[model samples]
Target: MTAPRRPGPAPALDLAALVADPQTRIIVCCGSGGVGKTTTSAALALAAAEAGRQVVVLTIDPARRLAQSLGLVELDNEPRVVETPGSPGELSAMMLDMKRTFDDVVSAHSTPERAEVIFANPFYQALSSSFAGTQEYMAMEKLGQLRASERWDLIIVDTPPSRSALDFLDAPNRMSRFLDGTMIRLLTAPARAGGRAGVRIVGAGFAIFTRIISKILGGQLLNDISAFVSALDTMFGGFRERATATYELLRQPGTSFVVVAAPEPDALREASYFVDRLSTEGMPLAGLVINRTHPPATTALSATRAEAAAEAVAEAGGKGAKLAAGALRVHAERMTLATREQRLADRFTSAHPEVKVRTVPAAAGDVHDLEGLRTMGEALLAAEDDTGTGTPRSRVLPLRPQAG
Candidate 1:
């Protein structure tokens, strides 16, 4: 057996090269909620499009930020071409509408008569709209559809803001289990078997089981579920197959997973979980993005020295003393924050030393337009410093001018 690979310092993630490559077809941005996955996805798409690659970004996030940034009044289930002036290539975007996508799948796969029946079923309505895991499953379905269209050179996916970042990856298996499960088989048995054989197949135990479930779910609801199961029976295998295909698409060579996180402990912990899960699932992890870092504008002054200087200036009580002291104190606080962020980052790197990382400094305000997204994209692809300073370009600051 081969020896285990040893961990080493993480190489800088060259996002520019990754997006520029024609072979890189799909990039999935995933992390815990509120880590800027949507922005990151949009920025990556913008970068690739400006680089002359046709791109479409699918956002599972419900927020209107992506649409706003792209200059669209709104986004829906269908892809809308974005007007990117001066860009050689094209860009399009869409938000996932789980219910509509589910309807499309049913309508596409079933006869009109059957489709209407399934659409009318109460169980189908509930499952398609608010069912657990439905969003994730629909995301997979939409992604598969986009890939089959062959309409774009690159696809960027911003995964849903779910409780767990791995929900997107688990969607296929969850769908498969639900479709082929014993519970579903039992639910549809009466419709499939019919008449006396159906009753015989169900027997006394099943009859009692159904009665208990009926009491809990109400007879009408139980009947609706049984009807829904029977109507969807023919399409069950199709759902499982499609989900499997999409899952495989994610693991393909052309696909890449980018874990987005903040410098905070909780966010980094979630990133670590995502990284570990991606490794376990054999997914191709491109790298990790530490977003919205508070890097100090200058590293020449240490926090201790800044605090000492502030105290000395306050004691001197000379001209501009209060203002100078306040400025130094502010710098001291900033330095302290930067130190904490770097310490947290180092902790993460020490654990997963082989994972590449790219840090994006926090913007002064929210990015709400194409130009802002372009700026964010440039920061993502900034060159890394190699002078043993352990500082990313986004985190580096010019030295302060010396006194005359």
Candidate 2:
């Protein structure tokens, strides 16, 4: 049998070329929460800009870090330029506002009077602003709009950190669920030519609930719902088609997904789940970024010292010494555990040898601006010295931007 191939040895990634590639229009940065997915998205955009490519980064990370990463106080639907020193490419960023995107869709498709009617509708408002899939669907809508605008050469997206990052992928189906569900038919029951009297009676009963909610919320809920349904009756097909197109766009080759994971087991498992789902949906899983990984050290000296400290504490036979030794032991164990996790990651890389594996060492500080992103890119594609030597040094691995 052919010797099993090793995980395509982590290759040096050319992020600029990836952004400049005529084929790649979208880059999705996804992972579980708190793994620096937002930072990675910004850094990728900044790196592309450094390489002289026009890029835009969009995110729904409500943590406000997206604003700070671009060194802005706030964000809205509009993209803002991020100027970094010594960077030749242009970069723009925006934090997605779900409500704004939703409103835009209505305004785009309907006249002001119709939009007012739709916006005032109780069910329409709830479905637009407060529903589970509304935000995700709006995000895709934003992506589609940006793609059509051709304002930026590259659109890098950071999805909401979700228990299932694939929530984004399911958004279209979820939106359709609202219209395709029994509730719509129940409301639209009057629009159908069933027994008119019974339909009116049932509709009147629904109106009672609508009026009560309107009174409680201080909005004309019934009128809004009626108007919204009336307008939506004319626009449902448009909404359905837009959502469908967005879903298709996500799965296309022009879009590439970067799955992010920290060294922790839970994060790795989440990444693995996301990878599997992306594969199932036929979305391109461009590569993986194993972040905050502990690099190996050259000093066999420190490891030896840690061992001696434990031995001395045992010999000393005192509480204070034991406590200090315990701390040392904790540090050593942490490093040992990190090494084991890195090995586990390597196994995954080996198994998916075709997938590029980039390791990003835990950076020293929080990323809050254009400069921070530049610093991040350094570690991402930093070169290694002739390490054919004996000492095992820590290496920084970044997620590959494009696999070639």
Candidate 3:
């Protein structure tokens, strides 16, 4: 019988080597919410730029903390230059605008008149702005646009958080299905047909479909949808073609996918899902980044030992007894947190031993400027060697526990 494989420590990811490669054109940072994906993306871009490669980091709904850290005062669809002191390479950053990107696609694919017609349609506006999958689809569109521009050597994409991180992979097919669905084809049948005979042939089916949809969506909404679909029918081929091209680009050799997460149970679980999903889809996996990990305050004292010391100090009841007791309690707390984080990380490493992981120790404060990000980039490499052989560094990491 085959032996059950035992888990081992994952190989360390070398961030410097990843960005130094000339052929590495795209790096995608993706994970569940609040795991520092945006900050990681910015830090990676800045580090790469500082190392002398022109880079652009595209973020989707970045948190204010992350935006401020990257010096993004007013984020929009357009990329704005970020001043990198002492760096020969340039760095630019932008946040995705789903509606504008959709409009741009429409304007590009169709004639001016047709584009206006499609844009004016209420259904088109609604879909572009608030549809469930529109943001992911537009992200793919924007990525394609950025690549086509050839303005930068490296493109770092910070994917939307939560399950939507996977949506980009499925968005093209979802869009294709929507366009080729029964309702859309039924609505566009007359448009596809030529002259009066074609209209007569399609009129009955179109009327039935419209009536059925009109009951669920109001009459005006159904009419708006039918009109929009008809107007967009000619451009559907182009949308699908571009989406497919973007999907292929993601799977290309020069592209790499980094799964970011904290050393917590739920976040690590999400990371595992990302790893499996990327592998199943045959995407190029560039290893994992375990951010804001905690190492014990002092290796000389264990959590139990700290607790015992605290108890002894409290019982002794001297002038400084309370202060000493409080300090011991704090040390115990730090040891407990570190042990919890280590166990969680080990669980993940055990499950996916082949996947490389780079751990960054928790920072003392929130990263809010260029210097902070540079420090963080350095931490990605430095923390690996600081295994607490001597003095302790920080108490606990600032990472929030992600919900599964």
Candidate 4:
């Protein structure tokens, strides 16, 4: 029988290598909820600092618990400094506030009078504050700001836990539904176009729909929507331009997107879909970071023997022995899963030889501070040195010019 072998601890990571790579400018961390993506972003920044690069880490909708980890009280657009130990590198972080970003954009684009009118309009207000794609747009906006900054050398972004990771990937176009679409005019038929067949039909439909809506929220609501749309009539093209620019920025040679996922089947599947989606859009596919990998207890035959002995003890009714064996079994199972992870990773490695691969083991506690970030950086950087002795590393990264 093949003896179970313990997997060695991953070697120290070389964060400096990733950031310093000529083609890499951005590192985006994405995964399902509760997968430690937020922590990963911070850790990369800390690691990058050790490598001697100035890093700015950004997060959208970070949990309160993790906000504590990143040394932030709450979400804000402004960046805060993060302390990195045993390194002279600089790091910063921010939690995105989508509503704030919208308000800022509106304030920038319109007169105070027009801004208030739009802000007070329920429909316009809802679109800005409660809309689905607001987070994505705001994230893009934040990236734009970071890219323009002279303070940092790198930007690490963590996306919200979304049903479709592509949501952020496609957000700019989706949010401006009214701009490119003629459906709204069709839906809100006016009495002016009476002679045309299509106008007449639309008017009749509008009459019935208006009456129903009038009874529910009153006609005032529709008036507000119309007014808001009119005031913001010129904003659509600009919004599209901004979104396109951000999308192009992602594809630049300097921006490197790190697709984050776990070893679990669903997360792995999501990672694959994201890869396919980015590839289809011609986005830069920098590399992949697999988190929460299980550590193996032994190597080769020793691991197999431990598993067998553990199973034998359980079969022999040695409850105490079984418990001891269970730990080894868990480790064995993780390594088994790790092998599967390796296979999937290998698939990518073989196909995209230029893309770098980084793996981080599951940490004991959730990361919440600069110190915790340093620990994560250490874990992420572990595989570079099997002997558990390596210096922290950071790399100076640049923003790929916004895509034209």
lDDT for 18 in candidate 3 is 88
Model 4, position 400: C-alpha lDDT score: 18
Root mean square deviation (Cα) for candidate 4: 8.7
Question: Each candidate: what lDDT?
Answer: 0.86, 0.74, 0.83, 0.67
Alpha-carbon runs more than 4 Å astray in model 4: 1-15, 21-23, 85-87, 175-177, 183-218, 308-356, 382-404
Which portions of model 3 show Cα errors greater than 4 Å?
1-6, 195-197, 297-300, 308-329, 383-404
As a TM-score, model 3 comes out at: 0.89
Better of 1 and 4 by TM-score: 1
Top-TM-score structure, candidate number = 1
Write model 2 residue lDDT over 281-387, tens digit each, in one string.
Answer: 88987778777776544324354577678888878887688788887676666557555665667666555556665667677788887778778776565444323
Worst 10 contiguous positions by lDDT, candidate 2 = 391-400
Q: After superposition, how far is residue 305 of candidate 3 from its true place, in Å?
A: 3.5
- RMSD (CA, Å), candidate 1 to true, equals 5.2
Cα lDDT of model 3 by residue, 190-307, tens digit: 8788889888878877777778888899899988988898888888888888898999999999999999998888888999999999999899999988888766655678889999
Give candidate 4's TM-score. Answer: 0.76
Query: Which should have the higher lDDT, number 2 or number 3?
Result: 3
Error of 1 at 36 (Å): 1.8
* Candidate 2: RMSD to truth: 6.8
What's the TM for model 2?
Answer: 0.79
Q: Residue-wise lDDT of candidate 4 within 220-266, one digit each (tens)?
A: 87777667777776565777778778888888878766677776667
Q: Residue 72's C-alpha lDDT in candidate 2?
A: 84
Q: Once superposed on the true structure, which residue ranges of model 2 sit more than 4 Å away at CA?
A: 1-17, 192-226, 299-338, 350-354, 383-404
